[model samples]
Target chain A: MLREDVTEAIRAAVFEELAAVGFARMSIEGIARRAGVGKTAVYRRWKSKLSLVLDLLTAFAVEGLPAPATGSLYGDVRALLEVAAHALRHPVASQVIPDLLVEAARHPEITEAVRATLLDSQRGVVAQVVRDAVERGELARGADADRALDLVVGPLYWRLVVVRDARLPEGYLDDLAHASVAALRA
Target chain B: MLREDVTEAIRAAVFEELAAVGFARMSIEGIARRAGVGKTAVYRRWKSKLSLVLDLLTAFAVEGLPAPATGSLYGDVRALLEVAAHALRHPVASQVIPDLLVEAARHPEITEAVRATLLDSQRGVVAQVVRDAVERGELARGADADRALDLVVGPLYWRLVVVRDARLPEGYLDDLAHASVAALRA
Candidate 1:
């Protein structure tokens, strides 16, 4: 396989392993075997299992997030929620994300890396959206952007992942967007 | 030890085990050893490892949740958030709850038990609170209780557990309650 194809294969294998067995039990050999690559090939690119996982998680975080700039704050917030819902609904993500959260809580290094790569970046995107709304006078100048961002993203997450609700109601995203806008305005 | 004391010791040991090693690795032998009881004694009260964990979890769920019925919907919602915040902040709960979520994702029985004992029960409480609001004319007759409950509880759970934020802003719950009320009204 070409270098890029090999890299993609390895990344896919890592996610599969993580989703199936979780971070605690995942091993380099298993990832390599699943990817059809030599163990040395795995070691050649990443120094440790933690580094390998971190690299994959960082890449996923970047690829998964797309900052929306739809004119209205509600539009932008809804767009972001759509992206998040799509990612969270993925089978691999549904399993791996929760497991990673447990791992992150146990390991300070993973927690800090997750905060920087995933949470901070996501927070930054929401902050920019809030800033745009403030500039457009769609939101108050001193509105709590941080709290607004949490409200915008939190409900869908709680339903999809925490409650493990099988199906979201029709127009759920629209309701969430409207409610989030109401919260921010308040 | 007295029967009650023995039971309490085993319960404490289970939480400690769950917090330290997580559900996948926790064992009856380890729990017995930690509690200073025989393995047979541990098995006498619980049929299986899963049952033991479930019993502990159910007990925790029942003890942790206390539905509030304050006169106003806002007051009741704020009261619920405070109760949730207290549970999420507990050292054992902060660790065990996240780990259990991962385990629940992997185990059907755990998932169902959690749904019945915890999520459904909490949702019921929120539903009753919303019902009371509608009766009191504090909310519209046809407000979406489920969505309102998610809006009310999601942000606090996301911040304290998922993001693991060290400190919530002062008056955070109040803001959440007010925003949730606005969302329902809108």
Candidate 2:
């Protein structure tokens, strides 16, 4: 395989392995077999199963939810939620996220990796959005960005991922966006 | 072992095993070994790993979050977040809830089991709490209970479980409870 193809193939295999067997049972051999590459190829690129999974996860996260400067806090928050909702709706993500979340609890190294990559990266985007709101004077200064982040992002995650496939009312994201804005302003 | 002792032992084992290895790697034999009983002992009590986990999860769910009738919507919502914050802080739960959530995505039977037990039971309580709020005129009538449920509980789960040891400023739950009520009212 070309170098770029090998890289893409390995990334695809890791996501599938996570979906099929979850993090605890997911193995380098399984990933290699699924990718149709030798285990050596897998290791030649990434040093271990943890590093490989984390590398792919970091790359996926670095795809980065767009930070919209829609001029209003409500507009920015809604756009971000729409992007997040679409991403969480992916087939592999719904399986892989909670699985890795479980792994993070068990391994300190995994915990730090996820915190630095997924958690920090997402929080940074939201904080910037919140900063935009503050600058607009739509939100009071000194609003807790962390709590605001939790409020905006959490419900969609709960409804979509943790509550997996629960029937949603029409315009669920719209309602959530409104609710999140109210929460932030309050 | 005495009959009740056996049952109790099995229950404890399931929680620990879930915390240690997660749902994917957890097995009946491992549970039995950890519980210091034969596989027959586990089998006699529950038909499979799925049932055992579900049964225990139901019992844990049935322990039920307090739906505080604190006379107003704000008071009640805050009370629930406090209870939920306390519950999610349990080390086993921080691990096990996400594990089962992942399992639910892959297996319809497990999905149904969790939905009926965890999702339904919790939503039922939150629905009743919202009903009280509407009647009290704290929140407007015609609020969406499903969205309300997500607003109240999601942030706590996100902060404590998924964020997993993110540092909090003082009175984090207080800020969260306040934000949740604002969102629900909006």
Candidate 3:
């Protein structure tokens, strides 16, 4: 296999290992075997298991976060929700996230990576969306943007990921978008 | 030690083991060792590690959930949020919950226990509060009680547990309660 193909295969194997047996039990040798690569190949790419996992998580975090400019704050909020919902619903992400969160609590280095790469990037995207909304006068001045951002994205995470309720009802997103707007205004 | 004392010791040890190594690595022998009890003593109280964990989780779930009748819907909502916030903020709970949630996704038996003992009971409490609000004319007729419940409790979980943001701003509960009511109205 080419270098890029080998890299992709390793990534896929890592996710599978994460799903099958969470982060605590996942091993570098096991990941190598699953990827059909030698231990040397895995070690060449990543100095340690932590580095590999962090790089994968960082890559996932930075992918496809578009700051939606949908004319109205309401539309922008809905657009953002759509992106979040899709990501949370991804099969690997749905499983990996909860496990990683627990891992983050235990490992400070992982926690730092999550905060810097994932959480900071997400916060930046939402902040930009809120900033645009405020400039357009759709949102009132001095609204707590941070808290409003939490309200906007919190429900989907709660219902879909935390509660493990995968089957979202039809129009749930629309209703959630509307509620998020209402919460922001409130 | 008396039988009750042994059981209590075993329970405490299980929590410590869960915190130290997480659920995937937690074992009955480890728990017994930590509790200063024999393995047979641990087994006598509970058939298996899963059963012991589930029982402890069920006990925690049923401990202190009261649907506060605070006359006003707003007050009731805040009360419920307070209860949820307190539980989520508990030291052991803050750690164990995320671990158990991941475990639940992999294990059907844990999933069922969580649904029946924890999620359903919490939902029932929130539903009762929403029902009272609607009957008192504080909430509109035909409001989506289920979605409203999600809104009411989602932010606290997102902020405290998921994001691990333990320091909520002053009057955060009031703001959340107000936003929830707005979401319900919307």
Please name the candidate that would achieve the greatest DockQ relative to the true structure: 2
lDDT tens per residue, model 3, A117-175? 54666787788888888899978876776687689888988888777778899999998
Model 2 per-residue lDDT at A140:
85
The Cα error of candidate 1 at residue B171, in Å, is 2.2
Candidate 1 residue lDDT tens string, A64-168:
355699999889988988887886798545777667777776777788666665477778888888889999999888776678767887787788887888589
Q: Model 1: clashing residue pairs?
A: none
**Ten-residue region with minimum lDDT total, candidate 2 chain B:** B57-66
| Candidate 3 Cα deviation (angstroms), residue A129 | 1.9
Candidate 3 regions off by >4 Å?
Answer: none
lDDT string, candidate 2, B95-148, tens digits: 777788787767777777667655776787788898898888888888777888
Best first by lDDT, ranked: 3, 2, 1
Q: Model 3 reproduces what portion of true contacts?
A: 0.72
Question: Residue A65 error for model 3, in Å?
Answer: 1.5
Cα DockQ of the candidate 2 complex: 0.78
Clash pairs, candidate 3, are none
Using TM-score as the measure, the top candidate is 3
Worst 10 residues of 1 chain B by lDDT: B58-67
Interface RMSD of 3: 1.1
In candidate 2, which residue pairs get closer than 3 Å at backbone N, Cα or C atoms, i.e. clash? Answer: none
**What are the DockQ scores of the candidates, in order?**
0.70, 0.78, 0.77
Better lDDT candidate (2, 3): 3
